[model samples]
Target chain A: MDAYEDLQQATLHDIPRSECLQLLGVARVGRIVFADDEGPVALPVNFRMDGESVLFRVSPASEMCLRLNEAKVSFQVDRLDDFHQTGWSVLVRGTSSYVESEDLPVLRSTRPLPWARGFRPVYVRVQPTQISGRRLVDD
Target chain B: MDAYEDLQQATLHDIPRSECLQLLGVARVGRIVFADDEGPVALPVNFRMDGESVLFRVSPASEMCLRLNEAKVSFQVDRLDDFHQTGWSVLVRGTSSYVESEDLPVLRSTRPLPWARGFRPVYVRVQPTQISGRRLVDD
Candidate 1:
């Protein structure tokens, strides 16, 4: 309704797959979304990008462990700055499964050391079938 | 594995409703989880706390506009510090509906001025039917 709002164009533009993966590699945290009995649930997890998959650990009995296998899941990461009100978000839709015990040792050096304390022994990997991202910027 | 890891108990504790709402009020950004044709999606939105509900604006043709209203949705806000490896997360499960035209004026004073440009005229309000939160701390 005002001149400033009228003149400002905050355009939303798509970022390519290569760039989306780059952003995912750099982000330290992301939210994993999966279905629950009630509906959808989104929970924060420190994640690491390995090849084309995202890897994270959860408690053995956590909902993530119970529900996030062979299930359609989405993982999202973003950088939002309150001062500038500008940010980029990347969303990945994928199939997730628990990492077998045999593959666990290889991820020992992954960057995202779990921030949550306790025995988070179950490792989950999400192999994205589709990745898309968008950025909001002043034009 | 180490004494330090054993001694540093990362405790998980519940956050009360009053405090959960307080955290919701102070945080400027949160993720909304909803179901889509493919599966579930988690997208970040700059939001404001309105009494027991959260309000945000989106474009008319955006996926949020199509899938958000009259749907079971979850909104999450959190603070994570990697250095300390400690954070608090609040999750709100609720039903969202587009703000009626008659009620628009009252929400005009809310804190988050949508950063994305053009006219984001579709305003959404999510009224929480269930609110739960957890805090991770080093004890």
Candidate 2:
């Protein structure tokens, strides 16, 4: 190991956009934040990448769905592995729209969810206008 | 399983406060969000539990630390294990403050970070007034 690596502190510059997408891809879980009349609310969600957009399912009963139509929302995915002491994060900002049932063919291409399936997932799409990522590397 | 657990989907309120802390304890990772002049910003952090509180280190330079002092900051801890298809999350809304140097002895009992060995972590204490949690169960 190099002396710099032993230092264990490195700040990332601009990472490639694809790497950012891939990091978001691997992260099936993230938080979705939105504003309500009362205040801001954040909830955990399961998401999969769809070309330039991201797709996820939720229950209408979930207040999350209620916030989707009118409010701007954000999705954030990050990893911090204490074992390796390395971590990176991706933040997505976009407005959301309901995914029509007809689009399931395009949506299922990834088959990303390794977890147990839930109820017919009410879907929402987040199309990113701003995407950014950061990484903490060993020196 | 009990009929209640079987009847409907398991949601956030299904889990108890104590169990939520257990999930937070093992998570070892999460993000903190607070509102400021710009709006809401979420930043990832490495955190640990203190009784009912969640404590983490944030450098003085952190925008999160700057915005959160004495005001309500939301701390989130969650993990996704695809294999088991099960994970739990905890959110705490509390005020954050820098632990005073003189209070080190009291904090030591809570097993605060061994910050001296490596990065001199800035201690951030989040004393929660509102605690909520959620869980994912099979469909």
Which candidate's lDDT is highest?
1
C-alpha TM-scores of all predictions = 0.91, 0.76
Question: Which regions of candidate 1 fall more than 4 Å away from where they truly are?
Answer: A1-4, A7-9, A105-107, B1-9, B105-107
Report the number of clashing residue pairs per model.
1, 2
lDDT of 2 by residue, B25-59 (tens): 77666787666553454667767787777777766
Q: Please, what are the lDDT tens digits per residue for candidate 1 over residues B1-139? A: 3234455456789999999999998888899899998899899888998888998888888877899879999998888766676789899999989987676546455634677776677879888989999998888
What fraction of the genuine interface contacts, i.e. the true contacts, does candidate 1 reproduce? 0.61
Please provide, for model 2 over A24-106, each residue's C-alpha lDDT reduced to its tens digit, 9 standing for 90 to 100.
87767777766655344467776788776777777677676787864467778777777665677787877778877786445
- lDDT tens string, model 1, A25-128? 88878889999888998888888998878988888878778998789999998887776777899999999998886765464566346776778767799989
Worst 10 residues of 1 chain B by lDDT: B1-10
Poorest 10 consecutive residues by lDDT, candidate 1 chain A: A1-10
What's the CA error at residue B12 for candidate 2, in Å? 7.4
